[model samples]
Target: MFKVLLGVSRWNFLSLTVLTIALAAVTARYQGAEIQQLQLGLVLLLALCAHISVNAFNEYFDFRSGLDLLTSRTPFSGGSGTLPQQPAYAGVALLLALVTLLLVIGIGLYLTWQLGGKALWIGIPGVLLLYGYTQYLQRSPLLCLLAPGVGFGVLMFLGALWALGAQLTAGAGVIAVILLLLCSNLLLLNQFPDVEADRQVGRRHLPIVWGLVPSAKLFAAFYLLAYLLLALAVWFGLLPRFCLAMLLTLPVFLLLWQRINKALQHNADLVPALALNVLLVHLCPLLLLLALYWSNTATV
Candidate 1:
C-alpha cells in the first residue's frame, strides 16, 4: 500500500521541487543570511506536501477522466499505473491529496503570518496551481506549460528564500528563472507521449495544440534558453564562477534533444529521452548547488 501510494504521488519527480528549494536556501547562505534550521525544515516539508498533493490530485483526475486508461504507461509520462490497476486506490489517492492540501493551507498561513504577506502572494497561486491544474489549467494550452514552471520554479524558489528570512538576491532570481525554464521544458517533453491521450480528454497541452514536430522544436529552444540563462547569470556575476560547471551536463542535454527530435514518432524510443531530460533537470541544478557549496568551502 505504501508502495502504491508512492506510485500515485509520483514521488520521484518530487526531487525537482526539493532541489530547487535547496538551491534557494543555499543561495541565502551564500548571500550571508542566517537561515533558521526549523524554518527551513518547515518550508521543505511544505514544499514536499504541496508536490505530493499536486501529484495525487493529477492522478485522481486523470484516472476519473479516463486519460490514464488510454495512455501507454511510460515511466516518465503516464499517470501512475496504480489507480488503473487497483481502482480501490482512487479514494485513497484523492483523500491523501485533500489532506495534503489542507496541510499546505495550514503551512502557507503560518508562513504568511511569520514572514508577512509576500508569502501570501506565493501561497495563493501555489494552491491554485495544485488544485486547478488538472481540472482547469491543463485544458488551456498556454497555462498548461507555464503554470508548472511558475509554481515549481519561481514561486517555490522565491518562497523558500523569503521563508528563511533571506533577501532575494539577483543570483537567486536568475537561478529561479533558470529553474522556471527547465521545469517548463520538463512538462513540455513529458507531455509528448500523452498528446493523444490528453487530446482525447480535451487537454490542450503544447504537443496537442502545436503538432509534435513544432512542439519538439519549441522544447529544444526552451532547453537552450535554460543554458543561456545560466551562462548570462554567470557572466553578469549573478552566480559563482564555479557555477559554470553546470555546463558539464551539456552533452547529455544535446543528446537528449537529439533523441527527442528523432523519436517524435516512436513512443518507446522517446522514453530514453524522457529519462535523460529528468537526469539533466536534476543534474544541472544539483551541480549548481555543489559548485556553490564548493566555492564557499574554498573561500573559507
Candidate 2:
C-alpha cells in the first residue's frame, strides 16, 4: 500500500516542485525581498501536496477509466501501472488524492490569510486545474497541452514568489513565462508515446488532435520561444544577464529538436528525446535558480 501510494504520487517527479519553489525563493531574494522561512516552507509544502494530489487524481481516474490498461507504459509517458497491477489499492489511491487535495486547500487558505487574498488568484485556479486535469482538461486539446505548464510555472512558481513576499517584477514574470513554455513542452513531448492510448481514452491532447508531426513542431516552437524569451529578458534588463546560464542547455535542446521528428517514427529515438525534454525542463530552472542565488549573494 505504501509503495502503491508512492507510485501514484510519482514521488520522483515531485522534485519538479522543489526546483520551482526554490527558483521562486531565489528570485524573491534577488528582487530584494527578505525571505520568510516559515512561509516559504509552507508554500513548498502546499506546492508538493498540490502535485501529489494531481498525480493521485490522475492515477485513480485513468485506472478507473481503463486508460492505464490500454497504454503501453514508457519511462516517461503512460500512467503509472500501480493500481492496474494491484487493483485492491485503487481505493487507496483515491483516498490519497482526496487527502492531499485537502492538505493543499488547507495550506492554501493559511497562505492566503497570512499573505493576502491575492494568493487566491493563483490558488483557486490551481485547485481547479488539479481536480479537473485528468477528468475534464484532458477532453480539451488546448487545455490539456497548457495545463501542466500553467500549474507548475504560473501557479507554483509565481505563487511561491508572492508567498515569499516578493513584488511581481517584470523579471519574475519573464521567468514564469519561460517555465510555462518549457513545462508545457515537457508534457507535450511525453504525450507522443501515449497518443493512441490517450485517444482511446477520449483524451484530446495536441499529439492526438494535431497529430504527432505538428505536435512535434509545436513542441520545438515552444522551446525556441522559451529560449528566445530568456534572451529577450536579459537583453531588456528584465532578467539579470546571469540568467543566461540557461543557454548552456542549447546543445541538448538542439539534439532534442533534431530527434523529435525521428522520435515520431522510431521508438528507439522517442525515449531519449523524452528524457532530454525532462532534462531541459529541470535544468533550465536549476540554472536560473543558481544564477539568481549567485547574483543575490554576490551583492551582499
Candidate 3:
C-alpha cells in the first residue's frame, strides 16, 4: 500500500492540483462566492490522478527512447520519476499510469454525464493534451513550449474551474494565455542544464538548437514577454488589473535566470540540469500558482 502510494509523483502532482484548486476557490471567492468543499476535493483528486499518470507514462516513454541511460540522461529528467535509476519495473510504471489514466477517464465520463457535454469537451481535450505532450509534441519546438506553460498551467486551472461548474470567461482566457507564455520560458530555463546530456542523447531541445547564449536569450525573451502580456491583460481589462500582483515573483525568476546563465557560462551544467527538472517539472508550477493564489486572493 505504502509503495503504491509512493509511486504517485509526490511534489508537483499534488502541488499543481492543490494550487489550481486553491486558485479556483480564490477566483470564486473574488466573485463573492465559495465552491463546495466536497466538489473541490473531488476535482483535486481527479487532477492529481491525471498528473500522476502523465508523469509515469513520461518515464516509460523516456526509457523507451534510450535517453535515460548511457550518460545521456539529465539528473532531473523532469517529473518522470526514478525510472532512469530503475527504481521500479518499466512495465509496472506503465501499468500505474494506465490505471490512473483509466480512473480519470471514468471520473471524466461521469462528470460529462453529470455536468453535460460542456465538461466533457474540456476533459477530453485535456487528456489528449497530456498524451500529446508526452507521446508526441514534447520534443517539438513550438509545442514543447506550451507543454509546461499551457498544458500544466492554464489547463490545470481550467480543469479546476470546470470541475466547479464555471464557464470559460474572458478572465480565464487571459489567465491561460499568460500562463502559457510564462511556462514556455520556465521550460527553457529548465532545459539549459540538460543541453549536453540531452544533446548526447539526441534530445535537441531549444538550448541545443540555438546553442547556449542564444537559448538563454530566448528563454529570457519568454519571461519578458510573459510580463508584458500580464501588463497588457491588466491594461486591456481582460483579467482583473490586480492580478499583476503576482509580479512579486520576479525576483525569484531573476535569480533563476542568473543561475542558469552562469551555469551555462561554466561547463558545470549540474545546477541548471538538476534545477531544470526541479524547477520546470515541479517547482515552477507549484510556486507560480501558489503565488497567484495568494496574490489573487489576499486583498479580497
Q: Is candidate 1 or candidate 3 better by lDDT?
A: 1
List the pairs of residues colliding in candidate 3. 193-273
Flag regions of model 2 displaced more than 4 Å. Answer: 265-269, 296-300
Model 3 score (lDDT): 0.63
lDDT tens readout by residue for model 3, 72-98: 344344444466555457777778778
Residue-wise C-alpha lDDT for candidate 1, range 72-178, written one tens digit per residue: 88888988799999998899999989999999999999999898786778899899999999999998889988987898777898888878867776777777777
Which stretches of candidate 1 lie above 4 Å from their native place?
Answer: 265-268, 297-300
The worst-scoring run of ten residues by lDDT in candidate 1 lies at 291-300
Q: Which is better, 2 or 3, measured by TM-score?
A: 2
RMSD of each: 2.1, 1.7, 3.9
lDDT of residue 12 for candidate 1: 84
Candidate-wise lDDT, in order = 0.85, 0.88, 0.63
- lDDT agreement of model 1 with the native: 0.85
For candidate 1, what's the RMSD?
A: 2.1
Name the top lDDT candidate: 2
